[model samples]
Target: MMTALLLHGYASGIYSSRRIARAAVERADFMMIVAGDAPDFRTISEFRRRHLKALADLFVQVLKLAEKAGLVKLGHVALDGTKIKANASKHKAMSYD
Candidate 1:
């Protein structure tokens, strides 16, 4: 349940422990994940500190799953108003003048 809350928070671009803790009480999605038992910021921070690596691994897994489900592509790129030399190759995106 806690993991679910944390993951949901991160996925929603809320990286602050205090924000996630507050969301657990205020946001419907977070409340559902926590089942009304909201953890305080300290608890969330401690969990994140202790399991930082594991959480990162899980996040990567989640992103992979999202990609597989066609929600996102792993390495999609977008260029805007940028000029690329016609001679540029894949190895060299752009050359410095």
Candidate 2:
């Protein structure tokens, strides 16, 4: 389960997922799995293409662990997204605040 969280949470490309994974890893109660070193951006991109579903499954496993630990309840859910223009976009070339 810890292994799953490491691979899915921190290693996943999604920013929020990585944050969740990092939080899980920091918890002393959870089992730990040491991945030697951080992969470079290119390697991460390759991993996403090659192992996306597997990583997603790991995320799910982490969620189950949280449920088992009584950290999160099984219930309703909501989702939302906010889009900001990329730095490369000339129309939105503003300094990050």
Candidate 3:
């Protein structure tokens, strides 16, 4: 059950244990997955920490299966800290009286 929670969270683009814990309560899909037995953030974090390598291996295997079934096309994804200026107007700032 815990493994399912973590895997489902990862597949859904949720990596933080805190966010996972929140989703278990707020998201119907997650609630259904856990059968209403939601673990706390600390428990989730500790479980993840203790089984990090195993979890990573399981994720890779699942990805391979997905690629085999044509469910996902694997590709390189990269992110950089290229900052972009916000387009907000100067007038949007609050002024003190």
Candidate 4:
């Protein structure tokens, strides 16, 4: 769903996220999700509010790791598209901001 919104330019909304999540579930096995079904709008909304900063920090850490691994070079473009999923449930998260 993040990929759908960020990369594929899908509009951000419950239905858009749900649609992407449901499709990924049908093609399962590689998808990492709790409940293995489309999440409710509240869940998705809360996740973004709670986890966006942490995820951004993680992304920076990944880039530093790549540089240390010699995978990053000046004047060259590279993007590692893999994402780690956090099992955020509505009951387990709080709004830290």
Clash pairs detected, candidate 3: none
Q: How accurate locally is residue 44 in candidate 4, as Cα lDDT from 0 to 100?
A: 58
TM-score of each: 0.74, 0.43, 0.74, 0.39
lDDT by residue for model 3 (1-97), tens: 8899998898899999999999999999999988998899999999989999998899899999999999999999998999999977767776565
> What clash count goes with each model?
0, 0, 0, 0
Q: List model 1 lDDT by residue over 1-97, tens digit each.
A: 7788888888899999999999998989898998999999999999999999998899899999999999987885887998765955756876575
lDDT of 3: 0.93
Off by over 4 Å in 1: 76-97
Which clashing pairs does model 2 show?
none
Please give the ranking of all candidate structures by lDDT, highest first, separated by commas. Answer: 3, 1, 2, 4
TM-score of 2: 0.43
lDDT of every predicted structure (CA atoms): 0.89, 0.55, 0.93, 0.53
Between 1 and 3, whose lDDT is larger? 3
**What is candidate 4's lDDT per residue for 1-97, written digit by digit as tens?**
5423322213223344456555445545314433355555456556656877875676567667878899875366789999999979875786656
Task: Indicate which candidate wins on lDDT.
Answer: 3
